[model samples]
Target: MPKQLFHHFNKYLELTEEHFQEILPFFEIRILKKKEVLMEAGNMCTHNHFVLEGCLHMFFLNDKGTERTVQFAIENWWITDDLAYLNQTTTDFSIQAVENTRLLTITHDKQGQLLKEFPQLEKYFRTIYQISYGAALVKMRYLFGLTKEEIYFHFTEQFPLFAQRVPQYLIASFLGLTPEYVSEIRAKKRS
Candidate 1:
């Protein structure tokens, strides 16, 4: 678990063995069953989870009570409500395991201490957050502006494994399309 975490961090910033060892204690490994909710709406998101295996989905209900998926985290990715975690405030989002999962989670206080102990990690996390934010911006534009077919194709092109790993309804929700519409599109493509 620590090895996987080390590999993830090393991609963004180089860390000395001593520094890595020092920060290792701050992370706690968690195993979650499929459909298990890690964080719920109206609760503070106290920890950021690093996926070692399986998938996680972050979503919230819209006014019509439909699930609107904001993000998905697979292996080697991080998942959390950034604003809630940072501000220690309640979140409108819920995070859950899409499959049985292995995670390394860091609490807000531990994250601060770990960063203080190894400043290089700050660069790694900042880069990760920037990328996440940029992706969110692009996704927002696509959701509102793109045609449903185009959005589906673009999503599959970018994250091909998502169609296999996630339920069709959830994928449809994320693309702002109805599940029946997604099925129709798939049928049309097959024909």
Candidate 2:
């Protein structure tokens, strides 16, 4: 585990150096290049990845063969097909790196063993999951309540770094807008 992993855990719970060291053995560091697929659709998702650096997005191809990006995980954030990972089943989603990314990944078996051994980690994970769920709810509210342009503005306002670091096309996919519409919105802002 890296120093960043320690800091990420510390944000949720007070983990002593000794406790953190014990937890490190359960995680492995994996690196991916830009556009690399970490996990492809139709496979069983075995690992939950926490981004130590760079960005990753979870997406699926819709009926029309258009990529629909549903989630992104940046530094200190986690990404996985939750239902698939939890049930140890195949998934319809793929996770891809948007940039060169370093991740701390834990296998499902190891995560289970770790949580059993370290009860404190259960609290940490619980907090993380609760916050993640809340964020999903909020994202849904924004997606439904706001107009497409308003959604873009809200997304940019909420995650300014994503607006800058991620390509407009990917952002547009995530926001359910076309790249051309995103361009128009940018031009509107400029004017």
Best by TM-score: 2
Relative to the unseen true structure, what is the C-alpha lDDT of residue 111 in candidate 2, on a scale of 0 to 100? 98
In candidate 1, which residue ranges exceed 4 Å CA deviation?
none
lDDT by residue (tens digit), candidate 2, 82-163: 8899999999999999999999999999999999998888988889889999999999999999999999999999999999
Report clash pairs, candidate 1: none
Candidate 2: worst-modelled 10 consecutive residues by lDDT? 1-10
User: What lDDT does each candidate get?
Assistant: 0.91, 0.94
lDDT of 1 at 34: 99
lDDT of 1 at 76: 94
- Residue 46's lDDT within candidate 2 is 96
